[model samples]
Target: MRELHEHTTTTAADALGEAEVAVLPTGSVEQHGPALPLGTDLFAAAGVATRVDRADAIVLPGVPVGVSDHHRQFHGTLSTTEETFADYVADIVESVAAHGVRKVVVVNGHGGNTNALRRAARRLRADDVAFTVPWHWWDNLDDLIDARLDTSLGHADAVETSAMLHLTELVQEDLLADAEAGAADSWGREVPGGADVGFDTADFSDSGAVGHPTDGTAEIGAELVAEAVDDLNALVDWLAAQRFEDLRPAPHR
Candidate 1:
């Protein structure tokens, strides 16, 4: 694994010089019901990032926290303000760019970080620091996911549980049955005469889980991981061969 955190300064300098893109896995530390670990997001992103077959890519250490304020009411969830998260992400990209890596790919595992990542990408473009892109692993594999299960992705649900089972040993398999039994089919509250409103996970699910956890399995998880890694590998290969100037903003009309 060519991880930035594991490399020596000299080795990193050499790797960066030869690398086309720096892959940074962004995840959140949040509750994943009773069956999965709180580090599910982090580990999922890191696992895929590390496994992708790209010799021209340098994988950075995973971001352990993100904009997860919605999950805060569920104990063990850590969060940062949206602004703070965006700033932190931008700073990381700028730092990597400083090392001469002109392209950066953020392998994101949390939905809450999407808007912040987009904002950060805008800032990077304005500053001409690097060509930055955020990729949500789930979004990239919708077809495969749909074929594997009828339910869409949800917090600590079948998708997440399966993913955690594949990527790490942190899942408490003994609790899977109970967790699945208590899982909710949907998120937040739906009103008859008003828009759906939700402040935290507690508002919708006492079990801290949305979706059917019973459907998850290590086999499905492995398949999901493989699909994501394949997609990411293709993206990196495409981006690595592009010219920076071509991707930069066009000259003012």
Candidate 2:
């Protein structure tokens, strides 16, 4: 693994010079029910980012906190404002661009960070500082998730639980039943007019989880990670072959 933090300044200078893309993992330190650890998202993002064995890509240290105010009612849920998160992400990408690796792939693990990440990516592109793409591990895996777990991505659900099992041994295996017992059938509470009233996770789920947790298995998690890594490698291959100028925005007609 070409992890930037593991390299000395001298070694990093050479590594950065030869790298065409920088992979930055971003996630949240938030509640993942009783069975899963608070760092579940971070583990998933970092796991995927580090597994991409590409000589032309360098992995940066992960951003461990994100926009997770919706889970504030749960313990150990740390969060930052959307604006703050966006600025932080943009700054990181800008710093990487200063090192000459302007092509970046932000491997994201938290759903709440979507808007902030998008805003950061757009700002970086507009400023011509970097070309950043926010990629979720579960992106384009809806079919596999639904087929294996019979549910979409949910907070601390089977999909996430499986990932934790595969990447780390932090899961409280004995509490899997408890997590499922308190889990909500779906994400939020909606009215007949299609209005969502569940502002906080506590409003909808007592366990801060959605979907079935008992269905998760380490075997399935490994499969998910393998597929995600393949997808990331393909993306990096495509990025590494492109010229930085071609990726930049074109002038207005």
Tens-place lDDT per residue, model 2, 1-253, is 6699999999999999989999999999999999999989889999999998767899999999999999999999999999999999999889989999999999999999999999999999989899999999889789889888778888899999999999999999999999999999999999899999999999999999998988999999999998999889988899888888898888899
- Model 2 Cα displacement at 30 (Å)? 0.4
Query: TM-scores of all models?
Result: 0.96, 0.98
Residue lDDT tens for model 1, 1-253: 5798888999988888888999999999998889899988888999889997556899988899999988888789999988999999899999999989979999999989999999999889878999998998877777777899877888898889999888888899888878777777788888888778867777888778988888898899999999999989988988998998888888898
User: Weakest 10 consecutive residues, lDDT, candidate 2?
Assistant: 140-149
Candidate 2 off by > 4 Å: none
lDDT of each: 0.88, 0.93
Among residues 3 or more apart in sequence or in different chains, the pairs in candidate 1 whose N, CA or C atoms overlap within 3 Å are none
Give lDDT: candidate 1, residue 54: 57
- Model 1 misplaced regions, further than 4 Å: none
Q: Which pairs of residues have clashing backbones in candidate 2?
A: none
